[model samples]
Target: MSGSGNVHLRQMARQDVAAGMELVQAAGWNQTEADWNRFLDANSEGCFVAEAESTVCGTAATIIYGHQLAWIGMVLVHPDMRGRGIGTRLLRSAVEYLESRGPLVIKLDATPQGRPVYQRLGFEPEYEIERWKLTATPSLHSAPGAIPLDDDKPDIEDVIALDAEAFGASRSALLHSVHRDAPEFTAAISAEGRLLGYTFGRHGLHADHLGPWVAEDQEIARRLLETFLDRSTGRCLIVDCVKAHPFAATLLGSAGFEFSRPLTRMVRRAVQSGRRSGLVCAILGPEFG
Candidate 1:
């Protein structure tokens, strides 16, 4: 444990999931209990929580993708405990723990309120991403070439390969976990059994999020999104899309998803090369990114 006063930091455990959810919920975040589970499952040793008088007051978790990179997320503190250094302490602990695994680069999507803190910690902007939402499902037409990716179809290895190319990190484990968790919303575009593009969805507390969405062309991207929207009708939906993508803004707007907020994708060290940002229409989520 590390802290002063009544606050102390410790490794998070499965039993702490509910308390973690409270912190996220108190912040009006879209994360669900399942999201909390993903963090703990991804790296239990990297998930840390701050407790004040034995109550969870803050949290910070990290997910390492091989030795090349690590993602810092869920750096949330209870509203009643803001400005008490709890958030900073939790973040520092997370970074320190992740650093112990070696000098892997750390990245996160920063909110306007949290960007300065990250900047002071040596993070620099990589690119901008935006959260778009659809409150009411729009009228849709089926795109000609889109196909359903069911449990029995689409080679998982191929999906991971494309995702790695687009995301610049091999997150096969994360992608597989997402498919296992919510396979109903998965779809792909293919020609002669060769994968061309794909998308996966997640069920969240606030809404259903569509992402890790990648495509080789605008039409494929549109079809993948259309498939998700058709299946996700009537539910609150969200997409954290790359602002620089040529088709992201237009596709979202045409589908009735309006701009919600802007997020800055920041890296702790210098930005690495090979990130195919253009092919990534939408990210899995800010937390995952």
Candidate 2:
């Protein structure tokens, strides 16, 4: 454990989930208790919490994607504790943990409010990502050609391979965890026995989130998204799309999604060539990416 005046930092424990949720909820974030558990389950040693007088006040978590990439997320500080440098400390701890693991890249999706802090810590902007929201009544019928993923599906391994190509890392564990959480919302598209695209959805505290949405083209992306909407009818839907993608924003706009917020994708070190691909229409989430 480390200390900064009255605030001290330590590895996050399962018991801290409720406190972590309180902080995210106060910030109006969409994370749930399950999300907290996901982080702890993936990297218990890398997630940290800050406490003041033994009460949790700040938190940060990191998940490494092989030795190639690592993501830092869920950085939250209680509103009452904002100016005390608790957030900076928490972030520093996360960085140190990731650096020790020697990943080639460390990345995070930064809100406007946190971008400056990230910049000061040597994170440079890579691209812009936008959150889009769709509100509509759920469709009663599933979109044709959108097949649900199952453990027995022969193409399941193909989906993971495709995701690794688009996302720039092998995150099979993360993908399987998401499917286990919401199997009904996960779908894939294939034709001629070849996988065309796939998507995974999460039931957030306030909305149904679609992401890590990948496809060979816009049409497949649309089909996957439509299937998610059909499965999660009458719920607010959120998608964090890659702004640089040729068709992502246009497809979302034509489908009646409205721009909700902006996020800057930042990296701590220069990215290697051929690590990522244009096939990623939307990211898993700022937290996961």
Top candidate (TM-score): 1
Any runs in candidate 1 off by more than 4 Å, and if so which? 1-4, 141-152
Using lDDT as the measure, which candidate wins?
2
State how far residue 89 of model 1 sits from its true place (Å): 0.9
lDDT of 2 by residue, 186-210 (tens): 7888777888888888999999899
RMSD of each: 2.6, 3.0
- Give the whole-model CA lDDT for all candidates, comma-separated: 0.84, 0.85
Per-residue lDDT of 91 in model 1: 84
Candidate 1 lDDT score relative to the true structure: 0.84
Candidate 1 local lDDT, 1-289, one digit each (tens): 2344778899999999899888878877888787778888888999999888888888998998866889999999888778778878888888888889997889999998788878878889999999998886565535443355563377878888888888888888888888888887777777887788889899888888999888888888888888887677458899999999999889989988999999999998767778777789999988989
Instruction: List the pairs of residues colliding in candidate 2.
Output: 138-233, 138-234, 212-283, 212-284
Q: Lowest lDDT 10-mer window, candidate 2?
A: 138-147
Candidate 1's clash total is: 0
